[model samples]
Target: MPKLLLLEAMGNTGEYILDAARHLNAEIIVVTHEDVHEDWYSPTLKAKIAEYGKLVFADFSDSEGALRQLKELARAEGVDGVVAGWEFLTPLVARLAADLGLPGNDPTRSLSCRNKRIMARAFTEHGIPAPRTVAARDLGEAYTLVRSAGLTYPVVVKPSEQSGSWGVSVVSDDEELADAFVVAQSHIFQMPHGIPLDPHVIIQEYVGGTEFSIETVAVRGAVTPLFPYDKFTTGGAKRAEYGHTVPAELDAAQVAVLQEAAVAAARAVGITNGVAHTELKLLPDGTTRIIELGARLPGDHVVALMRQARGIDEARIYVQIALGQEPVLTPTADTAAGIRFLTPPRGGTLRSVTGLGDCDAVALSKMTVPPGGRVRAPGDNDSRVGYVILHADTAAEVNAAAAQVLANVSIEVV
Candidate 1:
C-alpha cells in the first residue's frame, strides 16, 4: 500500500480526505501538533484517525525545526507523498515535497498562494485581473495608500494570512476604515500551530459583481478546470457565505471566461501540481476579476457537493495527484447540488433547532455546535451553527429547494 502523509488533519475537508484515503486502500499518516489534536480535532476525526491511520507529532510553530523533523519522518517511513490539511501548512508541504523529490507545487512561490499580501503582488506582477490591493502595517499607512491610490468608499480590509473570512470587513468611510483595520490586524498568529501571520493588513478595492468559485486540478503542470459554482453570501459589514449552488447557471461563454481566468490565476501562483480553488467576480460588463486563490481543495463541504452534483470525487483526485498517480476526472453524473448554513438570529446560547427533519429536499443536516452551546453573530463562517446539503437534477431546482429548506428551519436561541 502506498503511504501518504497529511499535515494537520482537523478541518472541514480533513475527514473527506481521510475517507478518500480509505477508499484508495492507502496507509495514511497524520502530522499534527499534539495540543491542537487534543483541543481542536472533532470527535469523529479523532475516531477515524485512531481506527485507520497513524498519528505523528510535530512542532509547526518553528518552520525550520518542523521541516527537519518532517523530513526525517518521511525518510524513516518511506512516505510516498505529502499533502496539507490546512492552508497555513500548504507552503510547508510544497517545500517538504520538493525536498523529498516528490511531485508538488513550486516551493519558491508557495507562500504567495497562502498569503493575501503576496497573492496581490503576484497577481499584479502576472497581470492577472484582480482587485487593486495594498498592504498596510498601520491605520495611517492604510489611509495613505487609499488616498494615494484614489480608492473610493466601501473598500475591504482583511488579514493577510487568515481564512474563513475571519477579521474581514467592508468599510464605507474613514472612521469605519480605522475600525476595520484594527479588526484585520487582530490575529497575528493562527490557531493550533501558532503559525505567525504576516502582521500587515490588506486593504483592497471591493469588486462588484456576482461571485463564483471554480475548482481546478493541475497534473504535472496540466491545468483542468472543473465545475464553476455560485457563491451566495450575506451582504452587510461582513460577508458570510450562506450557501453554494454547484454547476452555476452560466452560458458556455461565461463558463469559458471563468475557466480561462482561473487557469491563469493558478499558473500565476505557481500551482504546477495538486488542486487550486479560485474565487472570482463576474462584472456587469462580462469581464471577470480574480478575488483570491488557494492551492488546496475548496472548503465548506464543496467536495461533497461536487461529488453529488457531478459524480466527481475531487478528494480522491487530490489524493491520487499527491501520490503521483493519474487522476480520474471524468464526470459520472449530471445533477446539481447546494449547501445552506444555519445560523442563529442573534448571538446567544442555543436552545434547539427545529424543522430540519421536515425538509424533504435536504439530503443531510449536521449541527457543529451542541445544545446550550454559544453561537456567534452571523458574521463570518465560524458563526455557522450547522449546514444542510441538497441535491436535484438542475442548479435552479437545487437552489430553490435549498432556499425552501432553510426557510422551514428555525433556531431557538436565548
Candidate 2:
C-alpha cells in the first residue's frame, strides 16, 4: 500500500480526500495538532480518518518543529507522498515535499501562493493578468499607498494570508478604509492548529467582472486544466461566496480564454506538479484577471459536485498527481451540478431550518450547526450553517433547481 501523509484533516476536503484514498487503495495518514483533534474536530472526520489509516499528531504553529517531526515520521513509516488538505498549509506541503525529494511545488516561491503581496509580485514578474495590489501594516500606510499607487475608490481590502473570503471587504471611500483594515487584520492566528499569520492587510483594485473558478492537476511539471465553474459571491461590502455551478455556462471561445489565463497564473506561481484551485474575474471588456490561486483542492464540496457533474474525482486526481501518477482528467458525464449555502439573516441563536424538502431535484441537504447554535453574521464561509446540493440534466436546470432551493429554504435565528 502506498502511504500518503496529509497535513490537517479538519476541513471539508478531508472527507473527500479520505474517500478518494480508499478508492485508490492508498493508505492515508493525517497529521494534525493533538489539542485540535480533541477540541474542534468533528466526529465524522475523526471516524473517517480512523477507518482509513493512522492519525499523527503535531504542532502546526511551529513549522520548523513540525517539519523535523514529520521528517522523522515519514522516514520511519516509509511515506510515499506528502499532501495538504488545508489551504493555509500549502507552504508546508511544498517544504515537506522538497525535504522528501518528492514531486511538489517550488518551496522557494511557495509563500507567494499563500500571500497576496508575494502573489502580486509573482504575477507581475510573469506578466500574468491580475489586480494591482498594495500591502499595508496599518490604516495610515494604506491611505498613503492608495494615493501613491493611484488606486481609486471601491478598493478591496483583505488579509494578506487568508481564504474563503474571510475579512474581505470592498470600500468605496477613504472613510471606510480604516474599519476594513481593522477587520482584515483582526485574524492574527489560524484556528485548529494555531498557526501564526501575517498581520498585513492587502488593498487591491476592485476587479469588476463575472467570477469563475478553475482547478488544475499537474504531474511531472505538466499541468492539465479541468472544467471551469461559475462562482457566485454575495454583493455589497462583504464578498462572501454564496454558491457554485459546475461546467460554467460559457461558449467554447470564452472557455479557452479563461483556461489560458488560468494556466499562465499557475505557472507564474511556480506550481510545477500538484493541484491548483484558481479564481478569476472576467471583465466586461473580455479581459480575465486572476483573483487568487492555491496549491490545493477547492473547498465547499466542489469535489463532489465535479464528480457528480462530470464523472471526474478531483480529490483522487490530486492524490495521483502527488504520488507521481498520471491523473484521470477525462470526463465521462455531461450533466451539471451546484451547491448553494444556507446563510442566516443575521447573527443570533439558530432556531430552526425549514422548506428543505420542497425541491425534488435536491440530492442532499446538510446542516453543519444544530438548533441553538450561535451563528455569526453572513461575512464569510464560517457564517454558512448548511448547504443544498442539486443535480440536473442541463446547466440551466441545475441552476434553476439551486435557485428554487435557495428561495424556498429559510433559516430562522432567534
Candidate 3:
C-alpha cells in the first residue's frame, strides 16, 4: 500500500481525508501534537484515526524541529505523499513536500495563501482584482491607513491569519474600529497545535456584491476550476457564514468569468499542485473581486457537498494530487447540495431544538453542542448550534428546501 502523511487530523477535513484514504487503499499516517490530539479531537475523529490511520507526535510550534522530524519520518516510512489538514499548516506542508522532492506549492509564496496581509500584496502584484487593503498594528494606525488610503466608513476588519471568520467584523464608523481591532488580534496562538499567528490585522474597503466560492485543482501547474457555489452570509456589522449552495445559480458566461478570476488567483499564489479555494464577490457592475483564497480544500463540508451535488469527491482529488497522479475531474451528477447552520436566537444555555422532523429535504442534521451547553451570541461562525445538509435535483430545489428548514426549525434557548 502507498503511504501518505497528513500534517494534522483535528479539523473537519481530517475525517474526509481519512475516508478518501480508505477509498484509495492507502495507509494514512497523521502527524500532530499530543496535546492537540488529546484536547481538540472529537470521539468520532479519534475512532476514525484508530481504525483507518496511525498517529505520530510532533511539536508544530517548533518549526525547525518539526521539519527535521517530519523529513526523517517521510523518508523512513517511504511516504508517497504529504498533505496538510489545516490552513495554519499549509506552509509547512509545502516546505515538507519540496524537501522530499514531491509535487507541491512554491514555499516562497505559500504564506500569501494563509496571511491576508501578504495575500493583498500578492493580488496587487499580480494585477488580480481584489479589495484595497491595509494592515495595521494598532487602532490609531488602522485609522490613519484607512483615511490615507481613501477608505471610507463601513470597512472590513479581520485578523491577518485566522480562519472560519473568527474575529472578522465590519465597522460602520471610527468608534467601532478600536473594539474590532482588539477582537481581530485576540487570538495570538492557534488552538490544538499552538501555532503563532501574525500579530497585525487587516482592514479593507468593503467590496459590495454577492459572494461565491470557486475551487480549483492544480496538477503540475495546470489548473482546473470546479463548479462555483453561492456563499450566504449574515448581514449587519458582523459577517457570519450561514450556509452555501453548490453549483451557484449562474449561466455559462458567468461561470466562465468566475473561473478565470479564480484560476488567476491560484496561479498568482504559486499553487502548482493541490487545491485552491477562492472566495470572490460578483459586483453589481458584473465584475468580480477576489476576497481571499486559501491553498487548501474548501472547508465547511464542501468536499462532501461536491460529492453529493456533482458526483465528484474533492477530498479524493486532493489525495491523488499529493500522490503526484492525475485527478478525476469529470462530473457524474447534475444535482445540488446545501448546508445551513443552526444559530440560536440568543446567547444562553441550550434548551431544546424542534421542528426538524417536518423538513423533508434535510439529508442529515448534526448538533455540535449538547443540551445545557453554553452558546455564544450569534456574531460569527462560532455561534452555530448545529447544521443540516440538504440535497436535491437542482440549485433552486435545494435552496427552497433549505429555506423551509430555516423557517420551520426552532431552537429554544434561555
Alpha carbon RMSD to native, model 3: 1.0
TM-score per prediction, in order, is 0.98, 0.98, 0.98
- Candidate 1 shows a clash count of 0
* Model 1 spans with C-alpha error above 4 angstroms: none
- How well is each residue in 264-353 modelled by candidate 1, as lDDT tens digits? 999999999899999999998989999999999889999999999899988899999999999999999998999999989989999999
Candidate 2: C-alpha RMSD after superposition: 1.0
**Would you list the C-alpha lDDT of every candidate in the order shown?**
0.92, 0.89, 0.92
| Backbone clash count for every predicted candidate, in the order shown | 0, 0, 0
